[model samples]
Target: MRQNPERRTALLDAAIEVLAREGSRGLTLRAVDKEADVPIGTSSNYFASRDTLLTQAGARVYERLLPDEATVAQQMSSAVGTEGFVYLMREAMTRISGFRTGYLALLELRLEATRRPELREVLTKRVRADMDENVERHLASGLPGDAVSVRLLQLTLSWLILEQLTLPDIMTDEERDELVTEAVLRLSAPSKRE
Candidate 1:
């Protein structure tokens, strides 16, 4: 067995696809190995247990979808004021949609976490950290509101992402963008055109 982050990421990505398509029951270590098209025992070299694999896979899914440093920096430089905030929100939604399969696997992980207390706590802590980071970014970008506003913003975007991805045709892109823009404006509170 060799140590390779790329190999590890590939295995986790394979696991994500399995979880997304076949549900958790089918996500065996063998399935992950097969999914990655590697040797039969390759997954064992990376993950000690099925739960370990799944937990790491869940973390990987979120980790992969985080905003790229360059993009975040670019947004910070160019995106200011009400419209810029809307653009950043839109960018976030686009990222969510771009990683739809990974996000679906993430939802499966969330459900699985509920029955496993330790996993649940870990998931909660990680999710809260992500949220807190978003709030910090919002403030750094000079957007209005605090944690409450960020929560509302997250709720709004999550609902929009869920409905848009699952239902499809529930709302046109223009309509959805308008809804997101308005929600950001309301939650951000400064309203003045900057």
Candidate 2:
């Protein structure tokens, strides 16, 4: 197998694009090679099998979608109460939605994971780790949510994002923004004293 890290990354990036545009069923080594504009056998040299490519692509999507440290720090600094939680969730929704292709490819990876155990393992681990981190961050940042609230936001916002990505025409941007705000406020509001 080739050991050029740069080339491998390039192929994975291409695979992501192919996955987003073509869905999981259309993902092929030859398709990746074409998308990368490398020789016909280039992707094969970098990846041993279709499963390898699928798993790697799943990892790559998160790698590409992760917010940079500076952004995280900036966002974390401003987080305060319910409003702060609202801002944080809105920012998160914006950031995640901004990378349309990465998220779309991730959707493809999720569909493919059902048929491929290795891919399923990789995605489950990555997603779980991400959720754990988000829960910890929400707790530490003094956001208005408990771990349960954070988890709920994760589920609700994810579906909203899915709707935004797949059938954006269904709702206006302002309506989506309202939904995010409502979810955060309702889910994270302080409980009444007993």
Candidate 3:
């Protein structure tokens, strides 16, 4: 069967929606086919296997989170010498929150990737790239080399955001903002070399 780009995109989009609405555990070929309005055999023809489809869907989610290089450069240029970094970070976090299912699905994929060497390598590379981009952005803001600290800060902030989503009313916007501020300050602190 010849690959149809439009149909493929539709299937992937449907996969994301299904995953988001139902979590990773709810994802199934038939569900995706129905969501995409495509025939069941169509998904199998394109994806070949459940793992392949899920992995591709996960990769698509990651790609969606990252700002294009042009957009990042533009934002960085305009953000110089201002609190724009905080704004940008908040916006990024907000986007992540919007794709909560994608985040949860990623968590599931991470575990699955552990035993699948090929998937593991792919996930590792993608994660490393994200971390490197984040570290580079932080460093460019004049923060010292503290990659580990920055990673910890990111993890903490992500946890808080995810928790807020899972337990709405557990945290107010003011509380989340305060936590973000504290984490950013800690991560942006100058290193001992300074």
lDDT (C-alpha, whole model) for all candidates: 0.85, 0.92, 0.74
lDDT of 3 by residue, 78-161 (tens): 664325656666766777877776676676677668777766877888888888878778667654436776677777877886
Give candidate 2's TM-score.
0.96
Q: Is candidate 1 or candidate 2 better by TM-score?
A: 2
Listed in order, each prediction's TM-score against the native is 0.90, 0.96, 0.84
Candidate 1 per-residue C-alpha lDDT over 65-163 given as tens digits, one digit per residue, 9 for 90 to 100: 887889788887898788887888899998898888887788788888988776677788888998888888877777656667788899789879888
In candidate 2 the C-alpha lDDT for residue 86 amounts to 85
Question: Listing every candidate in turn, what is its Cα RMSD in Å to the true structure after a full C-alpha superposition?
Answer: 3.0, 1.3, 2.5
| lDDT accuracy of residue 79 in candidate 2 | 80
Best model number under lDDT? 2
TM-score of 3: 0.84
Error of 3 at 89 (Å): 1.9
User: How much lDDT does candidate 1 score?
Assistant: 0.85
Candidate 2 per-residue C-alpha lDDT over 71-158 given as tens digits, one digit per residue, 9 for 90 to 100: 8888998888888888888888898899998999999999999999999999999999999999998888887768988999999999
